[model samples]
Each structure stands twice: as C-alpha cells, then as structure tokens.
Target: MKVVPSRSSEWVGPVTSQKRASAIIEIDRVSQVFQTSARKDHLALSNISLTIEEGAFVSILGPSGCGKSTLLYIVGGFVSPTSGAAKIKGQAITGPGPDRGPVFQEFALFPWKTVLGNVMYGPRQQGVRAAEAEAQSRALIEMVGLKGYESFYPKELSGGMKQRVALARTLAYHPEVLLMDEPFGALDAHTRTRLQNDLLNIWERDRKTVLFVTHSVDEAVFLSDKVVMMSKSPGCIREVIDIDLPRPRRRNELLLDPRYQKYIVNIERMFDESDEAGAPS
Candidate 1:
C-alpha cells in the first residue's frame, strides 16, 4: 500500500545531501535519580551525553533496565533530569510542547474517540482550525494506512492498528523531533517488521529528527544512522557505532550485507564484553 503524504510533507530522499551538519538535539551529561520507598536514591542514568544532528535517524539500543526510556523521556520533556539537560536547537527543554512529539510503547488513544478524532486531537488542541486539522489528519491517516477506518474506535482496532493510529496522531501535528519509545515492541514478529519498513519510508519522506529506543538489534541496524548502546542499571553510553551502510536500506539486502552483519556483531560485542544484558543481534 502506498502512503499518501500531504504536500506539507513532500519527499526528501533518505540520503539527501545537505550543505553542513548541525546538532539539533543535545543531551548534555544528563542523569536521573528516583527515591525508593525505603528512601534510598536509585540512580537510573549517569552522565549520558549525545548530540543528534538535524534529520538524523538515531536509535538507542539496550537491554531491559538500561534507562533508555528515561533518557528519551528527558529529551521529550515528559520528565526532567536530575542534573545536566536535554536541549533542542540550543534551548533547554522544560516540558512537553508541539516541537517534540512522542509515541510510547503503549498506545495512548482515547477509547471514546474515532480514529479521525484521535488523529485530529493534537492539532485541534494546538489551535488549528477544524477544517485544516481534518484535512491534515485525513492525509496522515492515509499515510499510516488507516483511511478506511476513520470512524472506528480504539476498542475495534488491533494492537498494530492502534499503534499506527498513535503514530499518525504524532505526525499530524508536524513535530520537528519524533521521540519513539519501543513503539513496535507490543506487536507480533510480522507486524513489527512491517511497521519498521513503513516507518523508514515515513522518515525518509519527512526527515524529522528521530530518537528511537529499542532492544532489537535488527531494528537498530536497519533503521538508524547511528546506534548508541547503553550500560545496565545506571545507564551510560557504552559505545556510539556509526552505521556506514547506504540508505533507502532494503531489509532483505541488509540481512545479507557484510557491513550490516559487522555492525550487528560489533553492537553485540559491546554488550557481551561489558556484561550488560542484551538481545541477540
């Protein structure tokens, strides 16, 4: 199925050449801590730092309990760091705003609303007029392959479909940065793979700065320009691996490419050598 992108999001190929690289989002020595019921301070992240250039698709890969999601949350402004800061365009992020849109592991749609209503919710709240919001929402619904189900409520949709709605909703508001935390983690193997490819197409078209978190090696290898691995417990960057493979990456070809396999192996080695838990590449 073809994704019908709105003219507002016209195609810019996956590997479009740019004049100069510039950092759009900066994670500066960020750390996070939580107080346990016993009053012990539980440190979740320790001095994590990263800089994502504009229009780059970067993935945060780590095992369970690695605090990857916490890092993404801080960047999304849904949570504040204990120290340091998450900044976008050189401005410190204080709270959730229109500039950065987040799609979580769980689909957070309103059960009472239809698919169209859910997609339109963000723009309407942001003060876009009804007619214009509907036009943009319909285009996004088509992009995510939910055009025919516009009137269907969340209860009527499958897990993958609900996630698609969540994605469509996020894209409808035209965020410069898309912060996704395990958006496809809940889906079955086939659905997960399908969405991964589709997401690549969407990213290629829009060129938004993507900060994605996942435990899957194949996912990181196939989708990201850079893959940053994290350590266990008090998560910190173990290594930042650059994926040198050409973009408009085809999954079947990537599976067979020697460089792709090397990247996967190197990523796996980072975890194996460091005693950090990980999934098979």
Candidate 2:
C-alpha cells in the first residue's frame, strides 16, 4: 500500500489531535478472512489500520471487491475481524451496539411500520419512554426532510424518501459514530445529489464521526474530510488524500471548482495505477 505524506505536519496518524482521546474511532491492523466450505479461505482485508478524529467525515474509496463494505461492517460490529480490533471511545467493539448506528444501501425499515414508528424503533428498543422516543423520532424525521410524511409507510415512499427515513432512524438515538455502506448507491443521480447535500447538512448539525464507504471519487471528495483509498482484493489503505475544500459544500458549485476536479482526478489516477500494477502480465 502507498503511504501519502501528511498535508498538515501537526496531523500525524496516531496524534491526529493534541489529546489521544480526540480519536473517536480506532481501527488497528484489522483483517477479515472468510472460511467458507466452498472455498479454502478468502482474505478480504489485510492489516487495515485507520484513525478517525471526532466529528470528522471520512470516506473509504475503492473499486468493487476491495472489502469497503466489509471494513464498514467490521467497524459497525456486524462482523468480527479475523485478527485485529476496532475500537470506539476506547472500548473494543465485540458486537453491534447503539453507540454505532449503521445505514445500509438497502433501507431496512420494517414494512409494517410507519415512518414515525420506524424512526422511534431504535430509541424505544433502548428503553426510552414512549413520549420521549416519539419526540426524538419526530425531530430526526424533520431533520432528514421527512417531517410531514411520518404517517407514510415504507411501501408508499420513493427510494430517496425511504433512504431519508433510514437515515433519520439511524440518527434518532444519538450515536457517536455513523457507519454507512453506500447508503445512496441505489438512488437516481438527481436524488443521490440531493441526499448527499442533505446528509452533509445533517452532519453539520449533528457533528458525529461519519465513516462513509463509496466507490465514487466525486462523492468522496465532495463529502469527506479525507478520502481513504483502498487496494484491490486483500484491501489495505493505499493512500489517504486530504480534501482542502471548504465545508457546506454544494454540488453544482463544487462540480465546477477546479480543486474538486483535481482531487477527483488524482484519486482516479491512484486507482488506475493500482489496478494496472495488480494486473497480470
């Protein structure tokens, strides 16, 4: 894996902040191996290490089959790494917990539930009172632009609307970290762009540590504080590119900006180079 030089000297890998506790998520030498009956063994990740600071938005950028979703699932505690650890707030993640909320590509809202009920699900499950859960869910629903549609069922909503509900549901319980595996991947181009802006706006308000996994370089550059590139197959951090663009990023404005184009091109070049290097003679 290629190690990119730090853009800011003060921002070292381990000492990203003046205080060690500032690191909200720590992924140390994480590796995942699948031992299926059909295959002898498949190593999906190899020595993947990353440290994300508090309130920072980071993206894991790679081609398909690079274990991007696998890494995200590992951090979310849905899947355990073969030999390494994923920690948040100094505690090892052994299994799925409310502390880390996950938003998957498939909006996994219960079909029988209304939008309000779906958002309230997590908080209520955690033992919050009915009134309190509804209040929390209502606020999140509004934040994700689904305020008046609280009565609508998942079956009645569009893909974008469902994704909004999914996001609100994930954010209802105030998680310290958000793990999203291509949450907007299936949406149409226009809807995807709108949701991206909405997500950033929500992130600005909430300021949670977000780890987003996407294959699009443009999406990563537009949303991330840093774009972490991964190698093919046994995925590892190939490079970490710093995005120097200002926040409150808009799609049209950034799409026109030269710097944004440069970052996107640079990342694309890195992936192209990696693919060429990995190709057989």
Candidate 1, 144-176: lDDT as tens digits: 988899999999999999999999999988898
Q: How many residue pairs clash (N, CA or C atoms closer than 3 angstroms) in each of the candidate models, in the order given? A: 0, 0
Worst 10 residues of 1 by lDDT: 1-10
Q: What is the C-alpha lDDT of each candidate?
A: 0.85, 0.86
Spell out the clash pairs found in candidate 2.
none
Once model 1 is optimally superposed onto the true structure by TM-score, how far is the C-alpha of residue 1 displaced, in angstroms? Answer: 28
Error of 1 at 75 (Å): 0.6
Residue ranges of candidate 1 with Cα displaced over 4 Å: 1-21, 276-281
In angstroms, the error of model 2 at 239 is 0.6
- Candidate 2, residues 47-135, lDDT tens digits: the string is 98888878888899999889999999999999999999999888999999999999989988898999999999999999999999999
Return the lDDT, model 2, position 7. 64
Clashing pairs in 1: none
